[model samples]
Target: MPAPVLLPPTSYDYVTVHKVQGTTITAASDILAAEEPLEIRLGFGPTGQREHRTLAITMRTPGHDFELAAGFLLTEGIISRRQELHGILYCPDVEKVEERENVVRAELASTVPVALPRLERHFYTSSSCGVCGKTSIEAVQAAACPVLPTDGPYVAAELLHQLPERLRAQQELFEQTGGLHAAALFSPEGELLLLREDVGRHNALDKVIGAALLQEWLPLHQHVLLVSGRVSFELVQKAAVAGIAVLAAVGAPSSLAVQAAHNFGLTVCGFLRQGRYNVYSHPWRIVGAATAGL
Candidate 1:
């Protein structure tokens, strides 16, 4: 394989639309989030005899695709570290010119083992659903996701309060189309480190994690992760797998998400806005929280 080419895909597209308000219709241009299927392929086996397999196909906005592929593989337990990956590149032999950028191939080092049967459940994923394609509950718990350490990255309530506004301000695509979800990485002191956007919340986080992994920043035990929307079990699982200490969201968290967070010893904060938020589990990580009664 040749050196991977970085082709920037358009994240949004403009279309002519009729604006109707109070029965008055006017033609105007509207921006919409671009959703397309990204095919993630893996090349594994040995140096002399490598095998290619289609790993997954996800519906996501077309940008930062390389990061998305790397992140997906990491969260899915395909490759645990950046060293396991040989390279990630667009498929050079795509059948169509327009589809060249739609496919990404992740080359894995021969030293890495391949387990295709365990990952069959992830054949197809949509923008709206992350883990719905799961075949069994056992499969979901089988990944080698670690339990987070109890050490302190102790974040202040005041610092947490300011994160949503900071995350919102950096969401360039969301500001334009209002149809994209975002995932951001923040320091314990509330500094915005990195942000990724996509039609699917999972993909956005994958891109963020992928970038971190590529940049050799795994085991994010001292960092914070914030998502734009409600928290799901898949999101919790991903955050934990990446070794994120605190997972915050602008909206509420699901019951399973809270349970998983508690089990993994991760700090979960939901409804994080308006100078207040709910700490669902492991409140001890939040500085000045009274953990005596609970």
Candidate 2:
């Protein structure tokens, strides 16, 4: 069989590091979450008339890069469905072997137009709150996908309490380096579906979403998304675009994150630990939550 195209060589799995104590010195190795810059390119239009363009370069931990690129496109409102993509390939150029694994090219349908200018502005754009350029409530609405209702999929309070442990158990990289962030997808019954880790929290979210897109599992209304860190408006926006109903974070939620969750009708749960956690917005989906605590 031919070489598997998507499975590029991993750069670093573990590295050697030194440890020190007050009066003793020991040598040991540490697992590092490898950080690298990945360039995402888009190939649009049909055969013989395709236009290829550079999209963005993001710093991310290696692995699941193709998924990261795909998920990034989908959550950014670039491509909606799996069919919109024709293929994803490592840069086929023989001359650039050094970056052959670092670069990924997304082959989009000819009918699709690459929204580089808008995406460029959005990718580089930073906002104190809300999504890229989604400054006001109206602007957020205009830029986002249609809000998925927060009804149905009643997640038990007990299940919410266990999500952090479940998500952390599957974090292979975090257990090693204690440096990377993870985004995990779980079913309503609290089963782990997928977990992605990266140095960048947003990249981890993108990686998980990309995995879902590849599996044709968009519109995750019946599922829950858990991130390793605090909730941000961008994370909320990504989950909203993917139609995820419940978003849980081990850390707290930013003010705009709660606002975005509230505006989009998503259930935002934060500070999730053994017993105590806070519900920031749309508590309806968390069943029996009010009976337990405020």
Candidate 3:
């Protein structure tokens, strides 16, 4: 007989609760998505003269902290390439043992420049929203994320319909907790490639992008990114920064999110469930559709 395998401590927590369904009351153990504050610090400047700074603190589910940090930096325009990051590790000197895993330090190569003033404007981020403290839409545009290529990687409308089901199947943590959001990457052929889950929608996407970055699979120009929630301006910005051409969500897209997707030349698909979906921008990427009305 094999011993029961346990999930990572930071991924989820179990609580004994009373369940009242209709009229009956039953005590049961419920799993909850774990959310914790992660402080991201940066080490940049020339080799011996390197400087350290606290970049941003975010509340996120703790499983893939390194990927989350790398993705956050890439999407935030802090570091463009994986080579720019020398290494990512947990902070060694912490006041408490528990705090050690909550802090991550990303050391940047000497060639990479650190803009303290620019990075300081948006220092604190919450799990609910990534762009809460952003100054303006103009500031996001100023990040200079390149527009996606217009050529192929077209996906069928039928394939889009099947994505939600495939994504749901692979959501291991979500199945247990039902409280975490997910971000999944699929090939143009609709094959599920990678998936990440987190308490924050943006954090989930960041983890996916971060894992892709660390694996040297970036500039994901030919893939589709699907999120288990509504599309937001921040998600659009992050997708565009990662060079992902297609961004789909299970829910609706905010007006600003659609506008941003249009500006970035990234295709936006929303209301992605059942047998149909709405194409918010760059409809040409989705094949097998009737566009005669347009």
**Top-scoring candidate (lDDT):** 3
**CA RMSD for every model?**
4.5, 4.1, 3.4
Model 2 residue 140 CA deviation in Å: 4.5
- Residue pairs with backbone overlap in model 1: none
lDDT per residue for candidate 1 within 220-293, as digits (tens), equals 98899999999988898889889998999999998888888777788999998887899999988898644556
Q: Higher lDDT: candidate 2 or 3? A: 3
Give the TM-scores of the predictions, in the order they appear. Answer: 0.91, 0.89, 0.93
Model 3: ten consecutive residues of lowest lDDT: 1-10
Deviating ranges (above 4 Å) for candidate 3: 1-7, 126-138, 291-294
Ranking by lDDT: 3, 1, 2
| Candidate 3 structure quality by residue, lDDT tens digits, 23-118 | 999999999999899998898999689888888889888888999999988988888888998999999988999999999999999999878885
- In the range 1-294, model 2's lDDT, one tens digit per residue, is 112223233624666667889888888877666788888877887789888777777888778988999998887777888889888999877366877878899999888866557656644632212233346445546764756864567899888898888777766667767888889888888988888888889998999899999999877888999998999888888888888989999899988778888888899999998687888888878876556342
Please identify model 2 stretches exceeding 4 Å from their true place. 1-13, 122-140, 290-294
